[model samples]
Target: MSHTLLNESNADQYRTRVTLLGTAGGPPWWDGSDRTGISTVISVNDDHYIVDLGEGWGPQFRKSNLGPVGFQKGLDNVRAVFVTHHHSDHIVDLPNLLLLAWHNGSDGLKSPIQIYGPGNRGELPPIFAPENREQLPEVFNPDSPTPGLTESAAKLMEAYALDINDRMRDNAKQDLRDVFEFHDIELPGTTGDRPNEDPTPEMEPFEVYRDENVRVTAILVDHRPIFPAFAFRFETADGSVVVSGDTGVCENIVKISADADMLLHECIDMDWVDTLMGPNSPKPDANLMQHMLAAHTSIEQVGPQAQAARVKSLVLTHLVPGNTPAEKWQQAAAGYDGDFYVGEDLMQFGIGAPRG
Candidate 1:
């Protein structure tokens, strides 16, 4: 099936559209790939809400022209930010947004931009392979190894105290605390009680935030060993959009994405994983292969999940390896009869119908 590309010229056709700021997944710089880290923006008219802050998202966001142009005019229409999880690839550049907003026009905001993310895991994850468990690695930040969004933001500012102080005292910049508010997304009662043992329990999606433009709901997805990893659904007057974040095939993803207009899900090429870590390689590690597959959805698996969700459109993002050919990723459309597209950086999609 042919994929219709959406851009700023045709943005007015729909009241709500999603813009992919960056589509690359993981920390490694993939060979021969120019894709940046994974980040997305859901725009409702002039207002936009960000999901994830992967590397290079700041530059990508600015280039997309999601907000106003001109000096100190960017990020002015940013309504909120939703973090899928604390994974490095998903949130490594959070500091860029938090620290640079002052220079990017966060001062003119009508209200503090609300930032939401998963709370602390309450404990560190167990070691992946038993063979490697003999030599335990030292835990960093022993006192607060599992700091949640609130603490993470506070510490980030603390780490940049010198620059922040100089900017506020000399340049007259306001405190970041006043420009943004951090929130730790709380789970429903008894839903995430067993985080380590069972990270994702079968549960209904719960409302996390609501405003005039959108009503946001979240469900726990299985990105194993990463507790509270979420799949978020944004419901607006124009249509609904679901972000699968990063996960293997989990029923919770289907639960949250049901009947959505669009579902942007992550896809991994298992062939790549097998080539790298499967038996017959220089040094085969079956445990490592199993662990990788356990945490990420393979291309063959993602289509079935999207099909089960019954979403109208399935756009794949957060591509594993980041350098895999587009045809290799197209296998994700196997079981899904709905529209499918391989996401690209700065690509935008208009959801639902045009206003009359």
Candidate 2:
């Protein structure tokens, strides 16, 4: 396979900070259940860019001290959103995110946001199938078990709309027709729209966003058959961090994460999941969750990725079974001999200790 991952410079002219909202695939109810999906917010100064608003956003985002105007002003400060791929566990809250931003644009969420990702236009509604299948090459891989890049966000939303609507109760009244603007930012070579149908988009690999403090780079990784899966590397003046969305033993990821100060990767504690789910459990089904395991990375793989990249620390996110009730984060440290952090809802990590 052609690899595009590379070493990155975490250096910057200004400082940047990243925050974790919901870090598990299943929820993480405060009382202790599992349904909240993965969501993270990166803030450069007061400007915050919310990424992958999984399930628990309603409650988690509420944790922000920034009230209605806080959300709206923050939304106004956003630069753009870079999505890893389209998984309900990863982005189901996006529609709600837009709805809230639009509905509250005047007070809470500054509307007309711009989002970039692999699916059709901005996150596609799950069920979308173009009349011509060839148009979307990033999302469809017949050889893999999952839909990959081409999974229609529109279609997926349709599949889960009922469940979502039920939770929204009566408030699910609005139709979010034009909440946010969308840009398809795949790596070079993926879009046939360019000569010769390459797998990656043709845009500049690394970007200095509107804030300009942090540099972002997109790299293709192997979450195969899920066509068009990705990993992003973020660099700030203080340090660098790499986010591995979902993948299994991908060499390209090693390249993208190379030398970053920290790496946050999605992990499946295979041993834990196996022991917990057992043969009688109702999951790992032909349904959405089961399909994810085949292509996802396991904990066994994360340490090595960190070691190879020589990152200062390794953090784990988007965890399945979320290592609940079991010192999973500490256990992960056994794999590598460096600092490791496990993400939780509303968990905050900064460059250094909070001021005294």
C-alpha TM-score for every candidate? 0.96, 0.68
Predicted model with the maximum lDDT: 1
- lDDT of residue 187 for candidate 2: 45
Q: How accurate is candidate 2 locally (lDDT)?
A: 0.58
What tens digits encode model 1's per-residue C-alpha lDDT throughout 1-356? 12245877887676787999999999999999999999999988778999999999999988887778677558888989999999999899999988888888854556788999999888888877757677878999899988899899989999999988998889898776788999999999988888888999989999999998999999999998888799999998878999999998889999999989899999888888888889977768888888888889999899999999999899999999899999889988999999999999999988777657
How far residue 55's Cα lies from its native spot in candidate 2, in Å, is 0.9
Instruction: Give residue 324's error in model 1 in angstroms.
Output: 0.3
Q: Which ten residues in a row have the lowest lDDT in candidate 1?
A: 1-10
Model 1 superposed RMSD (Cα): 1.9
**Candidate 1 segments whose C-alpha is farther than 4 A from its true place:** 1-4
